[model samples]
Target chain A: MAEKSSELKLLSAWFSPMALRAKIALNIKGLEYENVEEDFNSKSHLLLRSNPVHKKVPVLIHGEKSICESSIIVQYIDEVWSNNNAPSILPQHAYDSAIARFWVSYIDEKLFVCAKNIQDAGKSDEEKKPHSEQLEEEMLVRLEEAFNKCSDKKPFFGGNNIGLIDIALGSFLPVLGLIEEINGRMVLVEDKFPGLINWAVNFAANPAVAGTFPEIDKLILFGKTLLKKMGYCL
Target chain B: MAEKSSELKLLSAWFSPMALRAKIALNIKGLEYENVEEDFNSKSHLLLRSNPVHKKVPVLIHGEKSICESSIIVQYIDEVWSNNNAPSILPQHAYDSAIARFWVSYIDEKLFVCAKNIQDAGKSDEEKKPHSEQLEEEMLVRLEEAFNKCSDKKPFFGGNNIGLIDIALGSFLPVLGLIEEINGRMVLVEDKFPGLINWAVNFAANPAVAGTFPEIDKLILFGKTLLKKMGYCL
Candidate 1:
């Protein structure tokens, strides 16, 4: 076993989905590391130095090297640990792996767009209603199409277990749920996307997810504050 | 040896960097394939059906499965042909692989932003001149910072080999170079970034790149026609 030292630390923010991905991956792999939470309002010099371009979290500092980008960090963890016993997150078959990666990339691109829309809506006033609704519909339509094409019999993305796809999608559920809660609108309605809703539930129920997820109340409170600061909340 | 007859087939567009990635990977690995060029303006039904969401080009159909997304396809190719004697594009060391992936991801995100700016500039009038210069400078600054920090001292992104980083960056060089050629300005001048310039030259000189690249003059003509159609050219 690799030496479990204080050297492996994760620099992250409390309510970041990207940060959660690294946390979940580490927990799933049974790796222990120190968590150094950053203040997003005023980032630290370490964070700036570690990831100068996109000085965002979560930044995984293993030994002296820093690994930014959540999805890439997860893949790195999988490679380093070789956790074959811990529910193979990535598919062994190359084609299946590609498929998993495609969905992950899609989530990175599409889901983030959706999240951005929700954030925009929260920050916008009455004049932006139509645009916000259109954005919401566009995001849902894409998700629905993806869900329809996804294998029907599979409990997870790849049929049997929670893999890379689950991790990618699962990371967003908290943010999605929080957005809906704060807005008092259901973007991912149960009837509209049963597969996605069920998947979300299953994902949330996972031990790793259940363990590391940010407290819902805390995030909701944070969202409310953010919206007010942005002059969205009345 | 793997069954040469059962090798994968790739569907690509003539002027697509994504397609070039798959093509280069195939050449690097010495894999035999049937290349069917798709018209981007009028995409084939097979391509559309294969990738409903994006409906984009550079779709690799390997036997029964279809893989879209250039980076994903390259990784898939690497995974499937793991036994091949070609140097593994992915670094063996975990930290090194992470670093390589970071650059790949950065290229996918930041470099594409610059490319989009250049493309948009080509489609704009004199009013957009400042925007184009600003975008060019932003791209150059980021590239310089990235290249400065790169671990490898070799001409390639990865040291002493053409790896994932090379493939990712190589795909974009044609478009970057063409943008400069069309604008009558050189963004990536040799004096400013000699390492990156050498890197581009080394990449262009690779047999895989030389064989598969589209004609520059033809591309410049096409780009001019495109700008004319978009009302940027008289």
Candidate 2:
């Protein structure tokens, strides 16, 4: 992917999965951007001005324009930077693109919500595990089926290379790891999700995704602090 | 939009806003399709098989393929049948498309959710209305702003044609009307949302969107039955 002339800036928080999706897509596209970090307690004026609706981070300022919402941002990246040399994040075919969009949405509305609920469960770990496990069983099993259906024996969700689904789910790895660490139980089990376990390994090792995840130890520490603030007795 | 060869079938509930979005897009595209009504009390096997992920209606079965989720289904219809003659629902430019998608998302998550909370609030009208009004002040006001920005002085959110945002927000008109009728209050106020008021009138009168809305009396009856089931007093 060749860089374009427009000055790209990402308003991001270091630990935010939403922001991470933007970062990974930018990296994959070979697009150079300024990372303008936001402090949540007091968000930056630019962020407030740029995203008046949600007033949230992961707002991508592309020259004069700003795009918000993580998945939409990723799609914008794929669309704008699509060139013959650049890898397509979304599939080129319309049906395939629809399927990819569906899964990406599932990641946003389902998988990520489950992970957040586990993180903020506030109950004793013993009291929380069953509910979390049930959520996982209902959600992740479908995801595994999605992987098989979408990947079509290829290595990545984008088939052969990283695509939209990869960026969507892969961004949550560090956070998922933190949840597992805190709960002292595996959220992504080897026995239950062998395909996903294998996919996760492949995803982390990919060059484009390698540095996109936050450092696990730091993430866990941050996670515990946030959980404590939310009334969890971690 | 010219008719395509693939046989299109829609599994739908009569009053679902989600199903209505798909129907509007299909109408705008001038694509003819079979409408299979579902008794949600016992959803059909085809629906169960077609959309195992959400297992909800508004699944578009094209020839041998089935696409679920209304927004995605709309997007798919736009992409697959995109011709020089067909009006593009999503904007052509990447930035414009992103902006459209963002507002469509707001319509789904914010506007529709607020409307639902107002409908499903089991408390007395006085008890429920203040909270609902506050939600409206926060949400519909932004939607009014969105209509102004996205529509850009045009008659519809799609600008010169009924685009994705128009379809997204327009689908809820009949349901919003139902809410207004049942509560004996105006959810979409003329003074507050003058632009949207005019836009809704334009949208309803458009030949493509005309007759797409379920009959108001039928919708009101169905809505009351649903609200009673949800423990709301008419």
What are the chain B TM-scores of all models? 0.88, 0.91
Clashing pairs in 1: none
Q: For candidate 1, lDDT tens digit of each residue in A1-234? A: 433758689998777888888988887786789899987668899999999878888899988789999988898888877754665667778887888888888888876765665566444656445545654676556655665566455666745666787787777877877777856787777777777777777778877778677788888887668755754321
Q: Model 2 segments beyond 4 Å from truth?
A: A1-6, A124-127, A230-234, B1-6, B121-127, B230-234
| Residue B127 shift from truth in candidate 2, angstroms | 5.3
Top lDDT model: 2
Number of the top-ranking candidate, with TM-score as the measure:
2
Q: CAPRI band of model 1?
A: high
For model 2, the docking class works out as: high
lDDT of 2 by residue, B72-148 (tens): 99999999989847689999999989999998888877777767666774657776676577656877788788899
Per-candidate DockQ values are 0.81, 0.89
TM-score of every candidate relative to the true structure: 0.89, 0.94
Give fnat of each prediction, in order: 0.94, 0.88
